[model samples]
Target: EDQVTQSPEALRLQEGESSSLNCSYTVSGLRGLFWYRQDPGKGPEFLFTLYSAGEEKEKERLKATLTKKESFLHITAPKPEDSATYLCAVQERKTSYDKVIFGPGTSLSVIP
Candidate 1:
């Protein structure tokens, strides 16, 4: 079975504070690792796509890295607007490419 789990269901941070959340996974033949940011009542906005281990991507206050077994999303100097649900997904080698699975996500709040 394919699965992805994230730690610290919710994280509270002050403005300019930095931290990282973890995404653990167990999947058969990973094709891609995806990171997304979602706000309330909206679909996730794709951030990064890690295709292999030791790969990394970044944008503004967010950085995503991938490993053989898991992925990490690091938030640096987060602002209040950066607060949202950080979602991690994995695309496995399935019969259909649309069968991507997502983690529950880490809800983050940045206090100004």
Candidate 2:
């Protein structure tokens, strides 16, 4: 069975601190990887989409990178407004269609 796992169930960082969140997966055939951010009482917001290994995407203070079996979300100099739950999802090719697998998510709190 294909599975996605995220580490550090929760993280607290001071404003302007930098850190990286991890997402690891096991799948038969990978199609794509996705990153999302969800604030309290809100739906997940798309952050990045990675198609192949060594691919990287960046937006604002966040950067997403992918490898053969893992993905990383690096946040540089985060702010209080950046507090949210980061989600990692993977799309794997199955027999007839693509299956999207989501990790439990890492809740991040940035304090001022």
Candidate 3:
């Protein structure tokens, strides 16, 4: 079975603080690693897609990197508006594109 687990169910950070969250995955064959940011009561917004090891992608305040066994999401100088649930999902070779699974997520709060 393919599985993804995220650590630190919740994180509280003062404004402008930086931190990194971990996403550990176990899959038969990893087809894609996806990162999403979801706000309360809203659907997730796609952030990055990492395919191979040593690959990294970045956005405004977030960076995502992938390795053989896990992925990391680094937040740099987060702001109040950056507070949200960060989700990591993986599509295995056995799973179809329409049947992607998601991790519970790491809820982050940036206190102003």
> Of the candidates shown, which would achieve the greatest TM-score relative to the real structure?
2
The local distance difference test score of each candidate is: 0.92, 0.97, 0.92
Top-lDDT candidate index: 2
* lDDT-based ranking: 2, 1, 3
The whole-model C-alpha lDDT of candidate 2 against the native structure comes to 0.97
lDDT of 1 at 103: 97
Error of 3 at 14 (Å): 0.4
Per-model TM values vs. the true structure: 0.94, 0.98, 0.94
lDDT of 3: 0.92
Q: What TM-score would candidate 2 get against the native?
A: 0.98
Where model 3 places Cα greater than 4 Å from the true spot, the runs are 95-99
Q: Please give, for residues 28-53, the per-residue lDDT of candidate 2 as tens digits.
A: 99999999999999999999999999
Q: By lDDT, is 1 or 2 better?
A: 2
Per-residue alpha-carbon lDDT of candidate 1 for residues 1-112, written as tens digits (9 for 90 to 100): 6799998899999999999999999998898999999999999999999999999999988899999999999999999999999999988886755468999999999999
Alpha-carbon runs more than 4 Å astray in model 1:
95-98
Clashing pairs in 2: none
Which residue segments of model 2 deviate by more than 4 Å?
none
